[model samples]
Target: MTTASPAPELSLRDKPGFSDLQGVTVEHGLNTQDMVVNIGPQHPSTHGVLRLVTTINGEIVKDMEPVIGYLHRSKEKMAEGRSYFQYQPTIDRVEYLSSFYDHYVYVTAIEALADLKVPKRVEYIRMICMELNRITSHLLWFGTFLLDLGATSPFFYAFREREAIFKLFEDITGARMMYNYFRFGGVNADAPPGWLDDVRKVINELPFRFDEYEAIANKNPIVMDRCIGVGVTSYQDLLDYGVTGPSMRACGVAQDMRKTNPYSCYNEVEFDVPTATEGDVYARYKVRMAEMRESIRIVHQLLDNMPGGDSAELRKLEKEHAKVAEEIAAAKKRVTVAKKNEEAPNAADVAKMAEKAPELPFDYRTTGQKVNLMVFKPPAGEAFSMVESPRGMLGCYLVSDGTPKAYRVKWRGASFSNLTILPSMMIGNLYPDLMAIFGSLDIILPEVDR
Candidate 1:
């Protein structure tokens, strides 16, 4: 009693969802039991904090279940407390890889509630940013997925191409990844002079880099062996679980949001939705690769036909500007007199500025007209907006109860549904192929647990 007896040799054994291996007897008098393995809330290939509680017998997986919510930031709940303007920054945390899509859906939801009219140029800019964001996301996926499959060089190669595009994003948005650029009616700011030229330059260069990527990895034996015919998902399986994006397209159903349900000037451009009938790891890989090329094609079309006024329209706007200049001078004089008398600018003084302000062509008006952001509110209504994110259909559902803050916000993240089919797919497969199948879905945990 005094010696403590070595703490009774503590062993964590025989728990639910797990059992000690020593308890089972095989036909040849060998003892065996299914082993439970925890893959991670920190595994490198999971792409975020995602855990797989798997039960394996020998080298084959008998059951696999995803334990999510590790990376949940409570984005929907956060929106309920914060004002619309205050909440924009946090949307980046929900889906950091292709965050433009998040902004697009969220902002469009608000725009619909308020019935805001966005300019054509703003639509074009948003589309360009979104499409480029897709390329960057897919490129990063292409890199990491191959790296997950035991190839190292493609990681560096894909990122090299991605860095050039990130520089373009940095120049425009000030922040590289978390860009709070989109506003309700339009973008936060205009594209600077020569920005379009820079975009044209980079997009022109990407195809060759893609060709180089294809040459190296498209038909590589190790990649092909690991990818083709593995983790097959049918089109009906996608529908049953609400899967979309490349995974859905890989099953030969063309369900791209850009094509099927046009948004943000996607209807103005023409691009084919790339598809494959196999619905396996190789098919998903092919679909994403093809989508990158298609995104580039869309960027070119959008840039080539950027919305702007003709020379005649420019001349007409200039004439209007000259007329406003005279009115503005008179208005400024009234303001000066009021200031000298130590009086605040009255309603007439405020109206004078508004009356004098020239109406710029929508093409030149990069951002929306001024609206008070500090205490903004939308009409009492509900809206559901969706965008085709790199992973799948990302939807934002908003309810406005005629208050400055939202009544509710709901995020339909693709990863949540895509991951649902994982356990079913993994049940009978060899254990090592887990990465091959899961990585192909391009599931990011933040998107799932948002």
Candidate 2:
């Protein structure tokens, strides 16, 4: 007899990539059931201890719920328990990549409440540190983002440049990562001898290195394929979600706080807020790349025309201060002796000597107003200050009970607001594209959980 009737053709859902989940099926005979996947809480691509409760159908992500709080260190609560100065060191851990920005917001918030005036030189130094920090932070992002996409060489290249900057930091701040160098009205110490020159040499060489990195990773077919069309959102969507920094700038919105609201010496410096209209992962990449160059430009300008004189001039000023201080002290002592003893030679002359005594040449501009930081207490009022940090607008809100410690402390970290948009961007994107999209956001976990 004839061969058995051909078996009924199998549905497309029965193919290799498809998996049957009970009997659920779509109109085309494709499986419609969803599969849940946990991408993090211990994964590498997450960049931190973030858990993504992702739902997928076959290879397509249907939904994503970010599970945060894993890295929470009770940073905000700690401020209330410690004196203002005591809490200064802990701020470095909030967003360790750009802790200078953290210190700037916290210190300046208290400065506003206390009516503390930061010197122009201190402002210039702070601006320099911040822009250099921006470069380092972006370098790390550059390396890690590409590494997530399967490229390895850029990681080492990035760290090589990062180490150079860290060495400069070590020379100035005495610590690389946890730099508690900023203070209420001035920096903790002036830049060390030749430190700025070292910074200049290192900063000058970075652009060439950046060029090399681009040559290696920028045009790779895999990078372009994965990044160009993936993870796009509308300009309105970015603003609606409260996204900022390079992520929002990628959507063709130039909403940089540095440009919109100038803080510190940013008004004095000249640079462009790099932006792109693609709203995709590649657009974000290009924005940050341009930003690094802009930061370099800012650093060069500040260094060339640094407000404080060179180290040699500062040394001379210190010597002159010592001599003038001695003269004023002796004059005051003579006046006191003459007042106590009527027989002392010419009481009127002694008084005249005290009046004519040279005033001590104290550089309040460098040393600030010299307040007692240990018991420093601001007035009973609230104040908030914000700065354009590498991530976005980093802000600090403080409530003071006219006490040595803060009554309430709040931080508005850019990563926290930026992370909210991930689920919206990720849904409907392929599972493999998750890293490409998430990395573009550059969400650091401490900022999210703090």
Candidate 3:
């Protein structure tokens, strides 16, 4: 009747969302302890100032909550105060791993608001830079991930390629890490002298190196044991969680923004979207590795299909342009009669004239009709644009009031949403598998916390 005096309740004081008895389990007829542990706001495995508040019983994780916002830089609010051009430099820090994608979404949003036309050469250049960037981002992820898995060789090999690519970036962008190169309708400058040759050289050598990387890790027993059959998430489950990028691809969805949404010059390129059906850590790893190879393929096509012409044709066009400039200078010398009244022209006629204007040759990049950034503003409107960033669908939403400052600006970093699935994937899994599971997601914290 006393029920053996009823055992006293044992629980931690004021733990959030979980009770001690809820996660605790008995093994071999002995009671086990349920402990609450904080993985990090500073640990290496957390990868950029993320804290995982995890609850575990024995070796199995019961529940986990991600704590972010440690690296918040007030990016959107700052956009409201800075002019469009003035904000270019700041975008680099938004997602330092793939800053070009950030610049593309933001610049394209403004271009849409203003109905600006981007030159074919500019688009091709942007696409090449972006694809190269995708490779670099994936390379970094590749190295760090293997390091997380206790393999150090891939990190060095990965950085070797990264350094070589960074050299190309520095020559063209004037900065290795923060490019700040994409303008609203063009890039900061044309590819520097012989820069295209350097690109071709690097790209030609990458395929072989990628094959070497694959040989090193693909069938290694340690890697397969740790990654395979772990962190399984179905395609349907991923959709419910709003996951995208390699995580979604690992679930065998083949969802890539470059293919489905086709931003920048992506519509012009042909490449495969790799996928896997297992939807586990190994599947995610395979998806990313294939993506790097696909990225190299995309870069090769971009170089081959680039819009530049033969050197002889470029010289002849340059001469003709100089002749036209001389004639214009002579005309300016004569006193020309000025017209009065400046009546509005017909929109139809203007459209017809625009249609008739001959396009400049490939070497002649569409540069300045010269809109200065300090005073630049788009018409009062809103625009949303997305791109296939390395992590996932990176997007930007901008609202302008026909003023130098944006009325509102919102960033859609993939890391923010991708991080949400962590706890769900971790629950009921072994605690030691935390690094393998979290590294597979490959979330960057700046984007998540920003």
Candidate 4:
């Protein structure tokens, strides 16, 4: 709980990799002029539709400015126009790769405002989904980052693992990407039968999968030559720019919200916050790789110690189970009599009768308390909920005027803040190093513009 001393004010000369270039001027002959080149409004390495306006003097970037908003969807404004339930689905677009983090912040904000007490099982479910999402986001970053550095096979390898986790997500949330699963008090539904066992199986295999990824790109010459010592940033720079998540941890900050703030079930889990002192592209890459392993460790703890069933909804369903089971047995006996009476029962008829059977409730409940989401309105107040997303600290500020729709909804995206330090990082570097620097930051544009 002790606070660290404030960072000292640093000059441009104090910046790593920029010190030698401070007083030195690039000498391009009269034949060569400072040329302005546009990297992209459409390019692969940008990670999205983003343009970097760069002034290069003979392959040396003299200046660079990120031109954003090409992918703007006015997500904050849409929250105002739509009801709380209506706006929940759109929350996925804020940060699609790790949308669970987005949903967690939004849902928790309302949960806090309304004073909803989430059950232990519900908290465990949210924690599992969010940690799995962290792995998938980092997997995509690992693959795409290596691809940016001129390696292709790792991209496919990364997706192979990512898709496996997504399949588990699909089994639970019924969607692969934009899973609007997390709700105000709980989740949309309970985990399907045998789903927890399936999750354990997939996560068990992930450590081996991570080893395969590291084997490919860890010591590769192309990766090292492009990433190491490139886009070097200091701790002061990270603090000044409001950089967070793995990018901030790379600068040796260890400022993860999960560890420091401890929302949801994060306080109960045991895991280390991965950090590196180099504060370069390679450092960021290394931090994210280590974080994925920590996420697996967190998942292992959550699954092993998950709370057993105490869902009120399940209790209610259990009360009606005996009657429903009796009715199903009577219906099956009628079907048996019909077969004896020389009436042919088709597969469709048998399936229709089978639908009446009572299903076994999930071992762990997905919901804590039930609320009619279509007309949910919290008391007049403001609450800011934050979570350690795959990228950085993702926060949602909600102001409720005792209405179903929020009075104000604002997002503090880590990408937007992380992207601010890019121009400063690229100013003294070579033109080709842009991909290495930007890719390492993992700037997803939808979250940036949202």
Candidate 5:
């Protein structure tokens, strides 16, 4: 193998869509040396501001190193001083494409620390929303991956359905993207009237639309030529690197956090975890398509068995419980002051005032029980939380110093690990195959940078 010295500076250009290098060639001969080319940081094909310093011999790749951190946001550090509830919104930005899953994992961690019990109805609702969000996220991946591969029509088609899903989210959460809807013990509120019907319509119509997508893209010879056998990461490689989600599932591993860990109502939901023996870009694509269908199935079940309960009622109950606690504390303080003074206000007066206090409103009784709404204080304990985010396994390690704030928060993002296998997959492949390989890895830069 010939080695070349690194170039001092390289000029990079951004191309709108993918391109195939039909006859382009790097200089190669017995006396010739390899050349270095910088593919991105701005190139549209890298998906999101990723830079690859590639060493090539003729048309074949020799070695490639991925350069990241172009979009770094100090999410973990930002979480340090913020209260657990306050930090939840920040988590939505970590993986912007799949904000609901991000919020779910963060809220679940806080709930675990506080030992809060979520209502059964709330759990089911969360499952429905998250699964819907997962489908929307995968739709985005499908559309963008195709865009990276030079297919424009599929992008539009996929987004049309994705808009429907986003509208559903907006109806429930009042936001399309960064939905900070999940609360500590439950959701911010319940789904609005006809929300179930909207979800049902989407779920009912999705399979046929997916069939249209497959007919248009899956069997296309060009897509197959670009995707098949490209960006292959072996099962052992994925395991060693701690990859998860459909990316790992594409490597023949059936380890889904929803299935293995069974958070929320995933354990009760019936769906198959899709897997592929080949860990190539095409296999990852197939896995995502299968996962979308599974999501539809889960949503269908949720819609069919939609529960009948008032979300406002639950919030009211919680508020009433809090009021009772405050009243009791105030009464205790008054009694303590009376005992400290040898002479004090009349006991009968105090008793009468306490008795005359207005009875808790009946509507307040509907609110879910008010458990302590204090800041999160984990018991000097450490817990590792992982969820099957759209990209892969998103993990958050929390070490609490017996305070409302986390002492240390370490995020183990799947995109970070999945990106590591790129150079290995890139070696020996042609230049255009790099786009195919990178698109197949299905990473979100924000999550990786976080």
Candidate 6:
């Protein structure tokens, strides 16, 4: 019983296996102890529901881990039950900010499967709308980034121009934010008559509007101090993390999906991929601003050389097909009545009329269908498609099981990869500098968690 007092009764708190404070420790050699903090799922600067668990040694972040999944919507699972046509609308939810680009990728994949050929005029229209959407997305990013850095007025100014672009989309697609416009063979509808003129007016006003925004935010000393030389992402880091779009261009990489991959008539357009050597927050900002200007230039060119044709030819084709079907039904009904009245035509008479029936010509070479509008079954294979979304390279890897729905769908979101490098940038930075780095990444949580 005396046995050294049974080693002080071996309290549960002292045992390694049972102790609640198993890994807790205090620094012995450091001048000041580090503190653990959470930046938040509620912090406005985080852009969405994101929590950063960080350890700070004074103002410098010693370690950080990002906690996500709060905005998860199970979009891929939702796509499984939807028909190919039905799923087109769901793409708008993947990256809510750049809904058109998301729709473009999904529609393009279906187009490839169905072997649909889009008209040249339709291609040009798609390019115009996509470029405009690109500019709008960039505008929102610029405004929000500036807001995170404590600037207020630029957000309003950027949104004013962004709203004009949204109105144009709404005019054509009939939906402002999430436009389920792009279809398997073509767009939902043709652009309105005065839409091109409205585009030109916005393009004309943008240069003056951009100049005003630049004066307010780009040249300000505070903005320069907060952004320049801060959150530097090296060219190699960008490549390693698979960053694209403005973020990669900011690091001096000239990889633009619109240029390299060249989808939706992007190759026909002439525009520069703006780049910067610094790879800092300011460089990303500069690249985005320059991109908006390039978008404006492309819009101007598109307006000047906008193709003129029966804009609603596709819709007309659908209507004509419907009419022909109705006529055929009527003829069948008449034949049935003639038989009932004992005046039915003989085989020779029926043959003569069949010979005279005009053949309905449908361009099915591109769309892989004999009829212009028909439910299609994609081949049992997989395809990967990428687009230059405002954030970065948005890619969709889809597998079809010879069914109406996709067997598997994987979204390679650029925001998810871009945000992975944030901790490295914030490692030795001050508290406020965190906002600058986070803002520059331009991450949308829905895109990541989708």
Best model per lDDT: 2
Q: List the residue pairs that clash in candidate 6.
A: 114-367, 115-366, 115-367, 116-366, 116-367, 117-366
What's the lDDT for candidate 1?
Answer: 0.87
Please list the residue runs of candidate 6 whose C-alpha ends up more than 4 Å from where it truly belongs after superposition. Answer: 1-31, 309-374
Q: What local lDDT score does residue 120 receive in model 2, on the 0 to 100 scale? A: 79
Give per-residue CA lDDT, model 2, range 21-130, as digits (tens): 55344534555777899988999999889999999877788899999999999999999999999999999988999999999999999889999888877888888889
Clashes of each: 0, 0, 0, 0, 6, 6
Candidate 4 structure, TM-score to reference: 0.83
Over 1-450, each residue of candidate 1 has an lDDT whose tens digit, in order, gives 687666554334422333444534242333456789999988998999999999987668889989999887888899999899999999999989999999999999999999888888888888989999999999999999999999999999999989888888988888889999999888887676567888999999999999999898889999999999999988888889888889999999899888888988888888999999999999999999999999999999988887752334545676888787776765666665755646645657667677758767666556565666779899999999998999999999999999999999999988888899899889989899999999999998888999
TM-score, cand. 6: 0.81
- Candidates in order: C-alpha RMSD to true structure: 10.4, 4.2, 8.0, 11.7, 10.7, 10.2
| Per-residue lDDT over 1-450 for candidate 6, one digit per residue giving the tens place of the 0 to 100 score | 556554456554444434244334333322444688998889988878999999886777878999999989888888788777777777888888888888777777766765677755666677788889988888998899999988898899899999998998889889888998876766666687677777888889998998898888888999999999998878888777766778789988889887887887677779898999899999999999999999888878777765553335444655676676676655666675765546655556555655666432332112223333336678788878888888888888888888877887888888988888888778878867998888888899999888
After superposition, which runs of candidate 4 have C-alpha atoms over 4 Å from their true positions? 1-31, 309-364
lDDT of 3 by residue, 282-328 (tens): 99999998998888888888777777632245456667777766644
lDDT, model 4, position 333: 68
CA lDDT of each prediction against the hidden true structure: 0.87, 0.87, 0.85, 0.86, 0.78, 0.79
Sorted on TM-score, best first, the list reads 2, 3, 1, 4, 6, 5
Better of 1 and 6 by TM-score: 1
Instruction: Please provide TM-scores, in order, for all candidate models, with all chains considered together.
Output: 0.86, 0.90, 0.87, 0.83, 0.80, 0.81
lDDT, residue 271, candidate 2: 91
Position 432, candidate 6: lDDT: 73
TM-score of 1: 0.86
- Native-referenced Cα lDDT, model 4: 0.86
lDDT of 6: 0.79
Residue pairs with clashing backbones, model 5: 313-366, 313-367, 314-367, 314-368, 316-367, 317-367
